[model samples]
Target chain A: MFRYILRRILYMAVTLFIIATVSFFLMKMLPGSPLKAEDKLSEEQREIVLEKYGLNDPVPVQYVRYIGGLVKGDLGISFTFDNTPVTKILMDRIGPSAQLGAQALLIGTFLGILLGLIAAISHNGALDYTSTILAVLGTSIPSFVFAGLLQRYLAVEWELFPVALWGTFEHTILPTVALMIFPMATAARFTRTEMIEVMGSNFITTARAKGVSEYGIIFKHGLRNALIPLVTVMGPMAVSLMTGTLVIEKIFAVPGIGEQFVTSVMVNDYPTIMGTTLLFAFLFVLIILVIDLLYVLIDPRIRLTGGES
Target chain B: MSKLLEVKDLKVSFNTYNGEVQAVRGVTFDLNKGETLAIVGESGSGKSVTSMALMQLLPKPHGYVKSGEILFEGEDIVKKSTRDMQKIRGKDISMVFQDPMSSLNPTMKIGNQIMEGLIKHQNMNRTNARKKAVELLELVGIPHPETRLNQYPHQFSGGMRQRVVVAIALACNPKILIADEPTTALDVTIQAQILELMKDIQKETDSAIIFITHDLGVVANVADRVAVMYAGKIVEIGTTDDIFYNAKHPYTWGLLGSMPTLDSDEEELFAIPGSPPDLLNPPKGDAFAPRNEFALEIDTVMEPPMFKVSDTHYAATWLLHEDAPKIEPPESVQRRMQGFSNTGSKDGEK
Candidate 1:
């Protein structure tokens, strides 16, 4: 197990390097720079601005310098943000995004699995059909549109929550809900499909033959096996929720990295762009590693060697 | 002997997309306490369905007993509510299913699997159930029972897993143990060991065993009585000696002939001629008439009633009628009948 985790960490480092290289080049390839587009200036004036940020250096030299900066735990200065260190800028925004993502993940996953379990056990009953419809709707409608609807009906019309901005628990509720719907739907659909499949498996029949009550059979034999597949989806689901919060943060006026990520991209704030991209990549890799470890814990049949032992 | 379980006209059907598939058609039999009754048949012949119906363990929304009276201890199980069946299951009756790998929950420990029924039905506390679980594992011939208690199903080999499954079935000393091809997923040597273990356990517990399997070879060793099922109906049933030596039905003869005997040196294996009839839109009369070489004219038009060949032997075949033309069983079947005695003498000599 230790060997497996070490190998995964090594692989994560390689993947992050590749992502950093690609995003750095892609940002440089874009038509714009951090300099203001308004007033025409002398050629030497342009040279002064370029030299100030080391933008005059060759692409390969800049790439090496960027890696060197990363090694020293410096993400350089954000061009568009009053020359604030990119890492400090991200640190300020990280807390809100992380908290929002965690809340949505906790609520979404729990409710989704519960809804899915209810649907699978009832199976073709009214509740099953209702959940199926709800899952479908959740997946189909975009979160921003759903966010708009919630803000209109739940906030603007009903005054259940504050209209916008991020402060107080009530302010966080609407955006958190909006962010949760898609993942919750995905989890529900995955759980429902897996639960139904697992419930009909031969082991479940054996459990039934043992005279295990319906609840026991579903909970003990059915759900545990079903959860394996659900866990596999959770890695991507976490990444999606973390990154997918960008539009939601904007609409709700939440001061998270997601909104910063978007604004950084528009103005070609290279340091912030690279920092956020690296952060997203790092988060995804960490989630997948955690998920792999969970597989070992949840199923004894699955060994750390990545095969049945 | 006292009757432990008696089934009267037990009919089971599965509601499929095509139509209702009549899986078990008016099958009737009785199991005596402390005896193993083997229900022998091909796949889809309602052998497993019969055992499932006895425990009311059929798949929901599809498979159900269409008509039946499963009388256990003088009460009809068919009339029992699902809640009532829960009490009866694991306590009054339990089952060992086919495929040991799938029968036991892969995620759970062998001890927990066995103790669950004891805890649920017998109302044993956790500590007592755990202690009894170790005892049950030892009962099923699992070595190092103490160390094995916490191991998951995947940790055990196929044969060991099956023993654990049998241990779970016997945890509460269920009145009747329904083994539905419990050894089918095991190797030949493992199969023999499991059969021997079941016989030994049955001797100790004196629980009636409903052994469902397609192997006649297995039936000879484990079964006290043999039931020959053909297309959802028991075409023949008799004591082991009667069914093996004095078999009356063509299907029984076909089954016995198909099995290889130690004394027989025949080069070509005798295979049963045709497949079992489909239960969905089942044949109008005898379901096995098309497959029976000596089928009478009336066999295709009318279903034969179970004729009493002797005090304990009954066969559902027109050939048993006195008026029907006398037809001897095939040469191969006659050889098998003689071979049984020959093997008996050989064993006696040994």
Candidate 2:
């Protein structure tokens, strides 16, 4: 097991490097230049800005310098945000984003699994139909639309949850729901379909034949096997949640990394853009690594080499 | 001996989108204590369905026992509530399914799979159940019982997994063990070993076993009495000796002739021509009339009830009617019958 974990960690490092390199070049290839945004400034101001960020150097040289600063735990400085270090700005805002993302994931996965199990067990009954409808609605409506509708009716008209902000628990509710809508829907649909398929497998029939209770058959035998497919989706789902929270954060006025990421992109703030992209890429890689490790824990059949030992 | 299980007029059907498919139609049988009764039939002949109905394990909302009286020790199990039926399952009537790999839980240790029933039904404590689980592992001839107890189903071979399943079924010492094609998924050598092990276990436990299979060779070795099923009904039933020797039903004759025998000189074995009748709109009279070569005019118009050839032997065929003309089985079947009779005489002399 220790060897397995070490191998996974080594793979994670390789994966992160590939992501960083791709993101670096991809951002450079975008239409607008970070220096071009200062067109309204005088030649002297632009020169000072270019020199300060080392952008006066060749693209390869700048890339090397950026990678060196990244390795030393530095993210240079944000061009549009009063020239503060990009890392410091991100660190300050990361807490709200992390908390919101965690809460949304927790609530979404928990309720999704619960409702999915209900749908599978009750199969073709009212509960199944209702959950299916709810999942469709959750997936169909965009997060911003969901947030807008909830803010309009649940907050504005009924005056239940606060419309916007990210301080108290009440302020986080609307944004969390909005952010969770897609993940929850995807998880529910995946889990429901997988559970239904697993429940019909021969092993479940064997369990029932052994006089194992209906609950035991469905949960103990069925759910664990069903989770293999569900686990595979979690990595991509988390990445989507982290990156896709831009619209949700804007609507709720939540000062998250996604909101900052959008702001940085609009102004072509190179340092902040690079920092947030690296952070998002790192998060995606980490989630995928965790999910890969989880495969072993959930199923003994999957070895580190991806074959039965 | 007293009857241990009596399934009378048992009928089972599945409600499909097309229509209701009558899977098992008016199947009846009795199993005596310490005896092995084999139900022989091809696939979809309602052999497995009949056994599932007896255990009340039919898939609900789609499959159900339309009508039946499954009496275990004189109590109607069919009429029992689910809560009450739980007491009988695993405790009184246990079943070993066809596929052993699927039968055993893949994730759980072999010990826990065996101990599950002992813990739940027998009310044995964890420690005691664990100890009993080891004994069961040893009982089923699994080597290195201590080490194997911790191993999962995937670790074991096919035959070994079946042994683990059988061990689980025997955990509570059920009065009747229903083995539905238990060795069907095993290799030839392993199949023999499993059958022998089952016979030994049956001797030790004296539990009446209901063995369902399509293999005639398996019936020859393990079964005491055999019931030949064709198209959702028992076409013939008798002692193993009677059915193998004086088998009366044309379907049984077809099955016997179709089977490859050790002493047969024929280059080609007989094969039954037509498929089983469609149960959605089953034939008006005999379901097997279309396939039976010796089927009479009346056989197509009226279904023949069970005709007693002896005190313990019965067959469902119009040929057995007093007024009907006598017809012998084909030349190859008669020759095989002669070979079997010679072998029977030689064995009797010993």
Candidate 2 scores an fnat of 0.38
**How far is A91's C-alpha from truth in model 1 (Å)?**
1.0
Model 1 earns a TM-score of: 0.97
**Candidate 2 CAPRI-style tier:** medium
Number of the predicted model whose lDDT against the real structure is largest: 1
TM of chain B, each: 0.97, 0.97
Maximum-DockQ candidate: 1
Chain A TM-score compared with the true chain A, each model in order: 0.96, 0.93
Tens-digit per-residue lDDT, A73-164, candidate 1: 99999988777999999999998899889999989998999989889878999999999999999889988998899999999999989978
Lowest summed lDDT across 10 adjacent residues in model 1 chain B is found at: B341-350
Candidates 1 onward: DockQ, in order: 0.71, 0.56
